[model samples]
Target: MDLVRIGDKVISRHKIDSFLTEILQLRSMGLSQTDVAARLGIDRTLVSRLENMGELRKGKSVAVIGFPIANRDEIYALMQAEGVDYVMLMSESERWDFVRQKSGIELFNAIMELIALAHSYDQVVVIGSGKRIKIIRAALDKEVVGLEIGESPIQEDKYVDPAELVAVIRAIKGGNV
Candidate 1:
């Protein structure tokens, strides 16, 4: 009985660590708090607490985004005590299948939703970004009024400066969005 209990505890810690890392990475990728919350069917406060464990957790109305966690019940209680959201367990195959068939526009909107939900100070930069992830670049082009940094093969003539890209995002927040 002792050995089995020890094994379970070890597995739980390993799962939680992986869950935390995945969540942070997804947030960096541009998913929003609200999206994450919606995905988990919980409030944004829970998400924030889950992300920031050591510091005093501050709740904001911003939409949050990140990975869907596994072992959610355990994470939830941990969040209550530690001030973070817990994991929502999904099998690896399930996660893969969801992304495999998701449309580009759907992916882009998903990313933007996450970005919008993030802290104002956080800048979610998609590096070497391309349209392959989804039809997001084109959709973003239409919906987003700011400067886009990446080069698009489809739009052979259109180009945007990297510095201007930051300015554009700032401007969008200022009123352009």
Candidate 2:
């Protein structure tokens, strides 16, 4: 345990941290603020204030997935800047390598896992060929925004305009897209 001496009193940082963790865990487990406060012997307003301090935004979660992208780095940076919940971007060579390195079952399991994760997001932005976008839209049940970089069977990496991607992200976060 670590102690901090302030003036003539000693404070237990560990105790404070444990209380914070417990409070958040209880809140996440569907406990109301009043219930959590009563259980923890804290003011209900403190719980509300703590939640507000940690809140990032007040909108739906978003995911961005793209492959065979020449500007993957640029797009990834934009996703990070916009605080996207999930991001998956790959170049043509990287995508080919990823498929070739995995066994048949492993590849299938990986694809299934990706689809399951995408299902958790409120919206998904798919950037690829028209055919690929159509396939993803068919697989996912949530709202999907398709930004077609090229026609079907895209064999080469296509450059995605960074400004266009930023606009899409802004619109989604603003709940207008």
Clash count for each candidate, listed in order shown: 20, 0
Query: Candidate 1: which stretches are off by over 4 Å?
Result: 1-70, 80-91, 120-177
List per-candidate RMSD values in Å: 20.6, 17.3
Best by lDDT: 2
Q: Top TM-score: which candidate number?
A: 2
The lDDT of each candidate is 0.40, 0.88
lDDT of 1 at 34: 78
Report the alpha-carbon TM-score of model 2 versus the true structure: 0.66
How does each model score on TM-score?
0.25, 0.66
Model 2: number of clashes? 0
Task: Please list the residue runs of candidate 2 whose C-alpha ends up more than 4 Å from where it truly belongs after superposition.
Answer: 1-59
Screening candidate 2 with a backbone cut-off below 3 angstroms (N, C-alpha, C), the clashing residue pairs are: none
